[model samples]
Target: MLLGIFIAASSAGWAIAQGAALRVPDVPYEPTPHNVVAQMLRLAQVREGDVVYDLGCGDGRIVIAAVRERGTRGVCVDIDPQRIRESRANAAAAAVAERIRFLEQDLFTTEIREATVVMLFLWPEVNLKLRPKLWRELRPGTRVVSYVHDMGDWKPQRTMTVQGRYGPRPLYLWTIGSAPDR
Candidate 1:
């Protein structure tokens, strides 16, 4: 009976044991350049009273910077435990750990309804797959920003090119419920 239960849970994409991820991450860990992070914050117009959520947060730089620079609270969600640990350490080093919460779990399953701004640095397909969840969970007027990828068929309200480690990378911004039909 226990083995059957385990099989059922695993088939549904649940982690088989503690410390394991519910599923493999959609992309590898790649830190966004500091310049791009700054631009993301600027483009998002992050400010006090805002609750920022960095989906698939790597090293927690985005959330850390948001909390430190804008006095906003943040949530860092990553499937990788290592990334979560790194994010926590980085947040502590930046002295903004109290303002940031780290969740070591799948970004797909993380609750983001409280966020006023959502940051994404994931792959194109991942962004596409995550679009509906963002649209459904986030409140109206919430800002969604993506680096290096754009959500398909959902036009961004604003787009800008920012210099990244590899050269110019595109940043996209969309306000939930403000755009026309997808």
Candidate 2:
């Protein structure tokens, strides 16, 4: 019955019944508009030699874009293997497969300390949950940019509003050292 499906479980309770080990706590996929994506990368100042990590990377657009636009390398992490496969296909189509590493793993546990820039478009609660990891792991001056949701309580260094196909959307940016230590 429901055994085959990995029901979205809460962080507090991980109910394992039939061995479908999947825990996705983020929001549904909503691709950041291309214009917004450009603005996000620009805000982070992604340049050549930079390593960008996209947490909960849906289709790997951010990673592909970073490599395609600025010759930077990128790592995209997603819990969904289908998304990882799609990411690989998209990277190949974008002609930047060599510059991207696609991983089908949990966003909260993946090691991204080497990232110079991290992009996100997750839900508000997930944003808050990820704040500590970003603060502790990312190096000082490492740029973290979010498409819509923001890290709660930890203020962004800069915030901007962009007009997309769906109208105005808020974007947030935070540098690692700007926030007080946990």
Among all candidates shown, the one with the greatest lDDT: 1
Task: Report the C-alpha lDDT of model 1 over 14-102, residue by residue, as the tens digit.
Answer: 44455556567899999999989999999999999999999999899999999999999999999988789899999999999999989
Q: lDDT for each of the candidates?
A: 0.92, 0.85
Error of 1 at 56 (Å): 0.4
Could you tell me every candidate's TM-score relative to the true structure?
0.87, 0.85
Residue pairs in collision within model 2: none
Q: Taking the tens digit of each residue's C-alpha lDDT, what string does model 2 give over 25-124?
A: 4677777888888999999999999999999888998889999999999999988766888899999988899988888888889998999999999888
| TM-score result, candidate 2 | 0.85
Give the TM-score (vs. native) of candidate 1. 0.87
